[model samples]
Target: MKVAVVLNPIAGGGRLKRHWPEVAASLKRHFGDFELRETQAEGDAERLALDLAAIGFELVIAAGGDGTASEVADGLLKAFRESGRT
Candidate 1:
């Protein structure tokens, strides 16, 4: 399946970026296709998640701390609810 990994570039003080390669490699092994999106600024993660949902991506993975995950989930859930897809 296609997976969109919405990463918070500033998360963990940019430590997340260092581990991205391993994360992407692991995802690639399980998913047919995968894409990475780095957050440019505040709220970017949620915006990216919403955009991914609008583009018909069934699975959007959020990789970050609690705050980042919450933002991504909120955005994805909003999109899912608006689309009436549960």
Candidate 2:
């Protein structure tokens, strides 16, 4: 599955940003290649997820806090609706 990782950089008060290099390396080691988007504002992850879905990614992994994950889910659902996905 082609995965998309939506990251909320401010999730843990910037911890994700601080340790992203290590986390990214680990993801690359495991997942090989994934579409990664670091959220800059509140709704960035959702927009990113919508964009990813618009292009038809098979899998999308929203890596962030509850709110961020929720936003990504919302975006995916919106895209699904717009695309007529069953």
Candidate 3:
């Protein structure tokens, strides 16, 4: 499967960023090769996820708290809506 991960580097008091190496290793082990995109600001994850979806990524995983997940989902939804899938 084509997988993309949208990570918020400073989420959860930076715990996610600190643990990302191990997390990436586990994801790679289970899912094979995947793309990782880190958010630099508030809207970056949404934009990245939208682009990823537009290019036919099968999955977009949010590696942060609820806000990141929501942004990713919104981007996916926007892509789908624009493509007449919804």
User: Judged by lDDT, which candidate is best?
Assistant: 3
Per-candidate Cα RMSD to the true structure, in Å, reads 1.3, 1.4, 0.7
Q: What's the TM-score of each model vs. the native? A: 0.89, 0.86, 0.95
Q: Give the per-residue lDDT of model 2 (tens digit) for 1-86.
A: 68779999888888887898898889888888888888888888889999998998867788878989999999999899999765
Task: Evaluate model 2: give its lDDT.
Answer: 0.87
- For model 3, the local distance difference test gives 0.95
Arrange candidates by TM-score, descending: 3, 1, 2
Compose the digit string of candidate 3's lDDT tens values, residues 7-68.
Answer: 99999999999999999999999899999999999988899999999999999999999999
Give the whole-model CA lDDT for all candidates, comma-separated: 0.84, 0.87, 0.95
RMSD of 3: 0.7
What is the per-residue lDDT of model 1 for residues 1-86, given as tens digits with 9 covering 90 to 100?
A: 55798988778988988888887888888886777887877788888898898888889999888878988998898888889877
Residue pair clashes in candidate 3: none
lDDT of 2 at 26: 92
